[model samples]
Target: MCGRFALFTPVSELTNKVGAVMPEREIHPRYNVAPGTWVASIRQASEDSAPTLEEMWWGFRPSWAKGKGTQPINARVETVATNNYFKSAFAKHRCLVLADGWYEWIKNSSPKQPHYLCRRDREPLYFAAVYAERDDGGLGCAILTEQARGSAADVHDRMPLILDDDSLEHWLAPDLTHKETIHSMVRHIDAGLVEHWSVSTAVNKPSEGQGDELINPL
Candidate 1:
């Protein structure tokens, strides 16, 4: 699950890459973006308009949830289409969760090492996500995950559904709701396209602010 991640890429760079308008507010660089925080997302404005950037809560809360428990931050791709909590969003609220990289802890090791996972070419990782608005006007989003493969499998059993440039448009199409067509667009990115390395354990703690030290190799 994508419990922790980082997105320190400049706002201007993101605007250029995704063709979305810059967020009006100044966005500070983040190194350890934890769950429950606001995250940057890209989604189509309408059926015929360009995609736009939005800052949404990093958890999914359905309108009927009544705000009483933990919201889900990651939804399994295998069951997202049929699960009650995620089906509607899965069908209509698709989005791109922007990040430069994410951190995952290796299991069965004393003082488990945290690893940074990202594209081998150092490009941004556009995670597949879905969003929904709560009754109180709050916006929430959840990252989609598929079974882990390659080196990522050694760290955890699951990883975010990272989308390529070719998949972005279809993944964010506002009117595409056919289950099979949508699911087909959410295929796994080849493991060879990604790389991972051990990083400082400081990421184990949740805090805000940017620092290269957080992602520095250990």
Candidate 2:
């Protein structure tokens, strides 16, 4: 599951990259973004419309789930289409989560090692996700997860559903309705498109914010 990640790209750069207008708030760089925090997401205005960027909470909780428990941070792709928690969002509230990279923990006899995963060329990535709005007008999102591949598999069984530039239009296109078309769009990113390295566990804490020290090798 994509419980933690990073996004250091400036709002201007993110707007240019996604071809979407930015929100009014100033977004600070986050090297240790955790669940329950607000993050950037791109969503279509309506079925068959251009995408627009917005800030949303990282966890998803439908109105019926109020006073239940912790909101889900990740939604399993295998069950998203049929699961009650994700079906509505899957069909109508799809979104793109912008990130420079993400952190995954590798299990070992010792403490789990945190690995930073990003585009091999250091470009930003877009994770396919779904979201819902609360009765109070607050928004929440859940990162989609599928079986990991390539180097990321070494750390965990599942990874965020990432999209390529070519697929961005198709993924964001709201008119597409075939389940097969949607399933086909969900895929592990090319191994060559990403690089991974161990980083200090300082990122285990989200309050650290951005710093050279978080990316430093332990």
- Which one wins on TM-score? 1
Give the per-residue lDDT of model 1 (tens digit) for 1-218: 99999998876677566588776887888888999889988887578778888898998997677886459999998898899898999888898888999999988766878999988888888899988887578789999998887878878999999987777888888888989998776555678887888988778877534587888877
* Location of the lowest summed lDDT over 10 successive residues in candidate 2: 170-179
> Who wins the lDDT comparison?
1
For candidate 2, the TM-score is 0.90
State the lDDT at 6 in candidate 2.
Answer: 85
Model 2 regions lying over 4 Å from their true place: 67-70, 185-188
What does candidate 2's lDDT look like per residue over 1-218, in tens digits? 89898888876776675577777787888888889889988888676456788898998887667747458999998898789878878887788888999999887625667989888888888898888886457889999988887888888888898887767766666775555788786555687686788998777777765685776666
